[model samples]
Target: MINWHRLFGLALEDYFTGTRYAVEMEKDVARKRQVLDVVIVRGTGEALVDPCDGLEDLRPHNLLTYKSGQESLDAWAIEELIGHYVNYRKAFAPREPAARFGLYAVTTRRPRALAEQVTLTPVKPGVYRLPVVGRSITLIVLREVEPCPRNALWEIFSFEAAKVAAGAGMYQWRQDDHFPILEEIYRRYREAGIPMSYTFQDFRRDLARETLPELTPEERLRGLPPEDRLRGLPPEDLVRGLRTEGRLRGLSDEDVAQLKDLLERGTSRRQ
Candidate 1:
């Protein structure tokens, strides 16, 4: 199962490096009995250059909710987020010029019906804008977004889904091309001083733990006289070991037959 909350929170922090933003993960407002997925506030200090264009408006206070690909973000969810905004203001009431607020909803599934009802504007392929009273909320559908290595958000959001589809199993680790790509993505974040949790070390560890130990075929098992390597072993044990070694080496039927013939001849000679 996907940990949408953690993924979103970590990804946001990885993308926005430095002291420019104060990020609160799973922040709770007691009166509302609601725990926000992620809350980002712009730092009062020097402003940093926006990494992705058009995201400059995400300053002050951004209320973000992440939905897994399996989850749906409907009209009700949207209304609930608006409610969160109201609850947020009540909890942290600003003095004179209140902090600017923006809502952001991110998901991996398509929000067809929801999009129809709201004033949704396309910022990019998978990214949409829903017009609110004061500011617009950004809705990002990960499935609809184009794959760009340079786009940290896209890489982070799409990583798991892609990995599963690619069959990134331990035995098939070499076959998976995404592993390297994911490693590079993490490297970029580390370079910017934001070390993410879903790192290359974690990837390697998982692969190592899950994969069964493999053994190379014994050199004597590969050649002309199979008895040279099979001496002193019981008949059943030798046969079992040979079968396993053969399977691992992907030996053809003919090769097995040749080994069996050699074994039988050696047995007759011994008798």
Candidate 2:
């Protein structure tokens, strides 16, 4: 088996740029960008940042959306990160050099706002890489930790590294303490020759739903309004009420034009 300890250290080394034997840096060091607790906009050759400024600003508005799930940090961290960048404004702007945020997470969810701007690909369970502009970021999921663990509160995803561009923390989540349980669940699945990426959140979801409910097509449509529904309606829904019941079976003029444009140019990459 590979040496997990050495590998862990190596990963950290890569994360911290190149830490020699892993002694924490007290202040920002130019070359050792690997171990920064946070990366602030520079001032007099130093670092200082407002953590709450980013994601916290967006929480009250629907600009930031989140849902509860099995893992604590996994359930919340990505949302918080989204809030952070949403707060950054220029962080994911239309024109910026490629840059990335180092992360530690217990789980991940689809980002709330920047989904269209960044191209995200899964690097590992609980880990992802988001390519924003030309720069790339490494994300890690974590769980909730508390002095009051019994209440099961799930908030809290920030860390020292978040203060810089490379914050990582040992965040606790719902199934974080149940490592043995997860290993066993995965082991049983694999032993039976079923392959799956088993995570703590996956185990918790299984534990929570004794019988999962199924959603049907009509049931799915119930939440959608005629305006929001994608039924090829056109004329900007102004003509919907007048003889528009099943009259507009085809796509809107805009949709057809968009399709034509796609066909003409095809999918091209940025230079």
Candidate 3:
């Protein structure tokens, strides 16, 4: 079952934070404060789902949900739902140009009181900030009545400042609000073109730029052919170089198998 509450927060979070940094800064000199807005704009993790294709499954009685087949709806599905509600509630919980989104629903599914003991206070309707995390994070608690196509949800928009004050190292991150599952979902959503998340092998493949090992006669005898230990200078040198090169190059599966076969046959042929 989809948690409409979690989904609501997620829909907006993924749009702003899940993508790369979206921010601009301004100083509140009078209050001796600095403010930043991570605005939503075209970037890597962006999409354009029409207000129509998004909300076919919402219903009023349900407080938090997106049922079976509909749950298959991916990240953009959630964002689209949020967008729909924002448009629907234009008169009520209208979008905040400063933050550029909206949300409205019971607070049951809101993020658990951040274990960090942080609390958010609405400076006014629809704007919230906490005393923790350098007070850089903020939630725009949306409060308006509107029809959302994702019937199971009441929408909410989230805006957070990623930039921390000078020297506030750890205080500036966009806290996940303890939702790794949704974090991954949006990760996949942002990478919609790719069907799968990156794996260790994928990482190795992507970073295939390491330095190659040095080749030497004794090293070849130690690594590839113990029997070739007694070979002459150039003979030993060539064998060692090729074996070290193979290892350094990150041999493919077929290459390794063929290598073992050649090794089993012995290095006499290479000589």
Candidate 4:
């Protein structure tokens, strides 16, 4: 089985790279093996260049609980998230105001059980505000989020094949090294018998195509051999912008003679 929780945590870490937030997975809130799913704490960096869908209002400390498509986001999950928050607050910053912390529950599917019990006020398309114990919790339904570049990270975890494919195409990883995580995600989806039309090879080629335009000509041709650099060009195209002397400079005597004869034959045919 795929470790969805760990993968999601790693993806969050990748998404928040270069931002002022540091993402910690399975954080120990207390000494008795009680761990929180994810914790985003204040760190050193600039703000996010493109904020995610439900994380626009990040506080100094953010606690997130995630439920995969197979998992149930029932009342116990909410209680667990709150329990982690309370313990984290007491252990780290007991005197800090509650406003300094943010609580979030991210699920791949709608939490019908929880919604039936408490009111989930719709804040936006996929975002909801849940009032519990005098604090508002942000409930983000991944599958329902707007399908755009900014929400691609959330869409990848939505468990819908189409959304996952779209998300992979739209997401631009902050760090190039994080590509392995994407590959692993693809492998997991295949392992779980999910029929994804977007293959890993397709994602790789598309990613290369998207980023290649940002490179300079020299950078693009950096590791190419001389033959490979001119592999597909026709003889005419190869010599198009060059003067006669420049074109013949690198040609062997036999090659030059062959080119001259070929040109003469072509000219005779045209005449």
- Give lDDT: candidate 1, residue 74: 86
Q: Which stretches of candidate 2 lie over 4 Å from their true place?
A: 1-26, 29-110, 143-271
Judged by TM-score, which candidate is best? Answer: 4
* Regions of model 3 farther than 4 Å from truth: 13-124, 144-271
| Model 1 lDDT per residue over 190-247, tens place | 5545536555677677765654245246532556486677678876775574556665
Candidate 4 RMSD computed on C-alpha atoms after optimal superposition onto the true structure:
4.6
Pick by TM-score: 3 or 4, better one: 4
Ranking by TM-score: 4, 1, 2, 3
As a whole number from 0 to 100, the lDDT of residue 89 in candidate 1 is: 72
lDDT, candidate 3, 154-220, per-residue tens: 2312111111111111111244452453344334333433233433243234333221245354543
User: Which digits, one per residue and each the tens of the lDDT, describe model 2 over residues 1-271?
Assistant: 3222222222222232321112122222334231222322211321212221111111111111122132233423454545444443343233532232232222223343444555556664333565543433454332222222221112222111121111111212222244453344334434445444434455456544532355566765786887677677666675656574455457798977787787667655331
Best lDDT among the predictions, by candidate number: 4
Ranking 1 against 4 by lDDT, winner: 4
- Name the weakest run of 10 consecutive residues (lDDT summed) in model 4: 171-180
lDDT of each candidate versus the true structure: 0.64, 0.34, 0.33, 0.91
What are the models' TM-scores?
0.55, 0.21, 0.19, 0.82
